[model samples]
Target: MTRRVFLSIMTAAGVSLLAAMLLILGMLQSAYTQRYRQQLRDEAAYAAAGLETGGTAFLAALPAGSGRITLIGADGTVLYDSIGTQDMENHSGRQEVQQALASGTGESSRYSATMGERTYNYALRLEDGRVLRVSAADFTLPEVLRSLAKPLLLIAVIVVLLSLFLALKLTRSIVRPINQLDPEHPDKAEIYPELSPLLDRLSSQSGQIDEQIRELRRKQQEFAAITENMQEGFLILDRDTNLLSYNTSALRLLGADDAVLGQSVLGLNSGSSFRDAVERSIAGEHYQRTMHHDGRYYQLIANPVHQEDGIIGAVLIILDVTEKDQRENQRREFTANVSHELKTPLTSISGFAEIIMSGLARPEDITHFATNIYAEAQRLITLVGDIIKLSQMDENSIPVEKEPVDLREIADFACERLSQAAAKKHITMAVHGSRETVSGVHQILEEMVLNLCDNAIKYNVEGGRVDITVSRDPRGAVFLSVADTGIGIPQSDRERVFERFYRVDKSHSKEIGGTGLGLSIVKHGAAYHGATLSLESELDKGTVITMTF
Candidate 1:
């Protein structure tokens, strides 16, 4: 701005100065020409007077430096020429001579091409009927200016320098106040009246901008709070699939680091389904897919972000559906297992009853068939009861209030109830450790302990021992452990033992005459009591299951 203003002022000054110089020069040229012409007339008249008195001798007496002089006869023949050049042109056709002949005196000027000068001629009609002429030659206007070129150039340089100095001062004065104005407080600046309106506008705009910035920051904070607290992974991407914004859950779910920001979404997970979902969303289509990442299933829901101009980007939501998927699979497996387990008992009962009803067996066979039927019916009832208990736990519909219960009492009760089974298996059962009280439903704890003891006796070797320990660990946590000398679980089947209907020895599960939900019940009851369950087992050695509350 300053440079433009300075240049403008300099240009105006230069133009004005140039015009003034040209005007003055033109006026001086006109005035000088007029004055020079008058002198020529005076010289011509004086020469004519001298010629009238002194005749040709007067011309001879004139100084050589005098201007050109000519005497012409009335017949228009050159009588005397001061320069004395031979064969001089006749003056008959000369305008000044013709005019002097007609009148008393005449003046004219012409350009001499050879000399490049303007020649002024003044003619006087002598009383002797002859013409006396005096002529003077001077450089033309162009020649005069050329001769004064150095001085004019010096003057122009001086003017330009002065103009530049003044222009600089003016530009500084004009621009300084503007530069001094505070953008944050434009209204407080003391400046030109013409700039007051501009300052007011600046103040207004600044206020508006500040308010807008604050609003944006507030909204950004709100967005951050919402996203940071989200459990599901959330991501925002540009049209090019570059990550723009993301939540912590997204980083964890995708196994990505913070460095993934501003990088392509594929950098986080380039799996086919993940890439497909993102690409489809970027193409303005909504897409969803189940993507398996890090051995966990994730539901990727990609939505195109739309505005008036069309789809500009995309939003990706990744939900950790691994638990849901596992539950679904469990439900299916449990349904099939329950059907097979129930059908087996009911089929055995039905077959035995049919044999008695059909009279296929005699009176001796009838009692035996009845005993088998009763046993199968009992097994069915137990299986149904276990299923109901598990269902109740699953739905959290157990209608029992919690109370402080002694772990030793529960362990002793379990040992008593399963004593007959232990006797039949020739397995020794014992409870050790002091009383450890925990807050729990009494019935649930008893059932959990019963299941643990029952499994220990049922799966033990003859003359093997089952030890139930009820005590407090060093951490003051109530610990209950059921260790047995039984056919230990294989390494492969150890982790699955706590799942419903999962058995370490599936081949002997039917002959074992027990529902497969024993450990599962223990697991659920432990979870309900806020306890941690751990297992240690070695094939052909023994197994130990511990619960800490």
Candidate 2:
């Protein structure tokens, strides 16, 4: 804006100066030309005085611009002409001729209807009584104007070029110091004393602004660092919907892995709750809401970022509390499940004890009661062990070292171990194919494979077949499959099956004499090795569990 103002001022000043110079030059030329023409007219009049004797030889003595001399007799008949015999019949009506007849000398400046220019015409009547007339241009202005064309054009061009240079230099000088303030060397281009006060005011203002900016930057970095370090996501934007900034945490929380700055925000991070919060913040408001993404919950906040001018951008902070929330929920659910499990056994034990104390049970009955109590105690022990294992996995303190291992051997061993369990159900456990040694933690891999095979066998119908296949597929990655002809998992529960202590069939899990942490452990184990585990099953149909390494 300042540059534009400077350019406009320079242009106006330059044009005014050029116009004044040209006007002065034109007046000077006009005055000089008028004086020169008058001198020529006087010399012509003197020659006309010598031509009164009817001597045609007088034409030789005429001045320059007294081009064609004509002497008319007293009766208006042409007596002599320098060019040739007179073609016109008479010349008495000519202004110069009439003026000459009036006195010894007469002058007139008028447009010649015949010549098409204002000419200086003069004439005199000599003592011998013949009329002499002379004429010349009033100022010879045509020749002067033709001669001035080159120099005038040159001067105009020079003025325009000079104005352009001034516009460029002056505009830069004016606009530069605004956005780029020089604290170190403030006296660089001291413009003028009139502007000196403004500069001083600006200098003081800039000092204050610098301190403010330092504080702002410090706070911005603090917020930025927090956002970068957080596991949740964050974003900043303006009312124009242009992206201002985002942190690593915000990107992850928003699931925008490839977000770009200065672009529109709608392309990524288009989560509806997050978008609405940003819009509200742009109006200088703050809001917080819980939004769900990827089966998790996040608390998103939109805060207005302000400067000295006003609110500039909206800062968004996303915090992923899904893990913590889910943990609390799990804790509550576990307390309930444990209380329920314990209540049943405690009731039975109490009832049996009461029966014994009341003599309602004989010695054999007492032995049976003791056996039932011991079984229930073992169930509680298994359940407690499962809880500890689940907690250990949750801590994730142990890291795994992955390497190629013989999966065929591990699978064979696990099958043999669980073969008895399968046999009790009259189910067939079979190995479909063998695989090359794939890379993974030996212990985790073994546990995961064993758990899948065990689940497959345990869930199978009587006389059903359980097939385990291990091989390197076309993807060049090694995978293991455990399929079962069992009552398949329901679609709704399939997603929850990998959650800790989650069981599709609680009664069945209890009857099978196993902990519900098997699938959760397998999921964690797969995650530790960066392998993939997927399950596909339908109710009343078979199920397939695949692990790719």
Candidate 3:
């Protein structure tokens, strides 16, 4: 800033000095040229008078001076020459001499080739048919300019030096007050009186700018806070596909660190498809994709941020849709299983009815066919009922009534309801525990206990023991555990043991004569009663399902 100010001052001074020098030189040249011409005229008139009065004796007697006196005959012959170069050139034929012959007096200026100098000439026609011309070597405009060069150069040097000195002083003087001004507290700074208005405006504008910056920062912080707390991953990218900002969720979802910021998305991971989608979004295309990565499912949505010119960046939102995807898969499987389950029973009933209608079976075999048809119909009814219950549980549409019920009594009732099945399976089942009270809907609790006991009997080994224990633990919660010496679930299958229509032994499932929804119902019912269900099972050892109320 200081250098700029100094240079500006020096430039102005130099230009002004140049203009003044040109003007003075022009005026001086004109005045000096005119004065020299006038002198030449006066000398010529005086000499002409002398020659007329004393003839050639006056010219011969005169001392030699800087002026040249030339006498030319009317017939273009040089009569006498004082400067001595008139030997070859006739003075009567000169422009001034010819003019003088025609009009009695003439003056002109020209350069002499022999003398190599310029001269001013004044010719006056004499009464004796001759011309008396006075000539003087005079400085031409070029010579005059040459004479002034030294002084002008000295003046220019002085001007530049003085301009430099003054420019420094002036620049510092003007800038000091402005530099000393405290922009943050402009009211307290001493400044020029003329700048008071500007200072006031500066102070006002400073406050406004500060406020706007603070507001912008505060808004940015608020946005950061909101995004950082979001469950879905949120990210912003620049037009170059570099990461501008990303939330904590985004970092976790992408398995990336904060170092990924300001880097291209491709550098963060091997998800080329994700990077491609981001590039497409930056090109003003909206993109969406569902990807399974790192044991979870995510839905990516990219939207371009467009301005008047074009897309400037993009906003990417990663949705953790793991649960949704799982639900969708479960629904598909349920549909397939429902079709298969219904088909099996319907086919049996259809085959038996066709056999009866065709009369292909003997009369004795008719009873057996009818019985099998009735059994198949009952199994179909059970499957339908289980499906309806599962749907209701999924919809959370069950009505609830909170009432205190004894866990021991529910276990007893469940065992009695499945006593025949237990007997048929030859499984020993008994309830042995202190009575514990729990507050929930009686129907839900009963259903939960019944399912657990039925599962214990259905999957138990022949003559295996089924124990129902209803008691309270140290936590003061009612605990009901149904432990069976059954074909235990495998470690891998334990996680999915409660899913609808999932049977561990599919080939023997029909022989077992049980719907695969027993444990699924138990899970839902226990959840409805606000009970925690835990399963401890081992292959070929035993399984225990405990419900803590």
Query: Best by TM-score, which number?
Result: 1
**On residues 1-549, what C-alpha lDDT tens digit does candidate 3 reach at each position?**
657766786788789987887787788878987887888888778788888888877887778764878888898787887756435576656889889999999878899775578888889998887888888887566776688899878987887787778778887887899989998888888888988998999999999999999999999999999998899998888899888888889878888775467888666657866777788899999899987779988898999998898888999999999999898999999889889989999999999999999989999999999999999999999889888877777677877758889889988998889889889878888999998888887877787788888878878999898999988879798889999998899988888989988888888887776778888988887777678989999877789999988
> Candidate order by lDDT, highest to lowest?
1, 3, 2
Which parts of model 2 have CA positions greater than 4 angstroms off? 1-286, 292-298, 306-313, 319-331, 346-360, 398-406, 435-446, 473-476, 506-513
Error of 2 at 351 (Å): 4.3
User: CA shift at 183, candidate 3, in angstroms?
Assistant: 4.8
Over 289-371, each residue of candidate 1 has an lDDT whose tens digit, in order, gives: 89888899999999999999788899999999999999999899999999999999899999988887887889878888888
Candidate 1 achieves a global lDDT of: 0.87
- Cα deviation of 379, candidate 2, in Å: 1.2
Q: Per-prediction TM-score, please? A: 0.86, 0.50, 0.70
- Give a tens-digit lDDT track for model 2, residues 98-198: 76777666667788654567777666676667676565556654666577789877876777677677778776776665546466445454464556777
What candidate 1 gets wrong by more than 4 Å, as runs, is 1-3, 83-95, 112-116, 138-144, 161-203, 221-241, 247-251, 254-262, 267-287, 302-316, 356-367, 473-476
How would the candidate models be sorted by TM-score, starting from the highest? 1, 3, 2
Task: Return the top candidate by lDDT.
Answer: 1
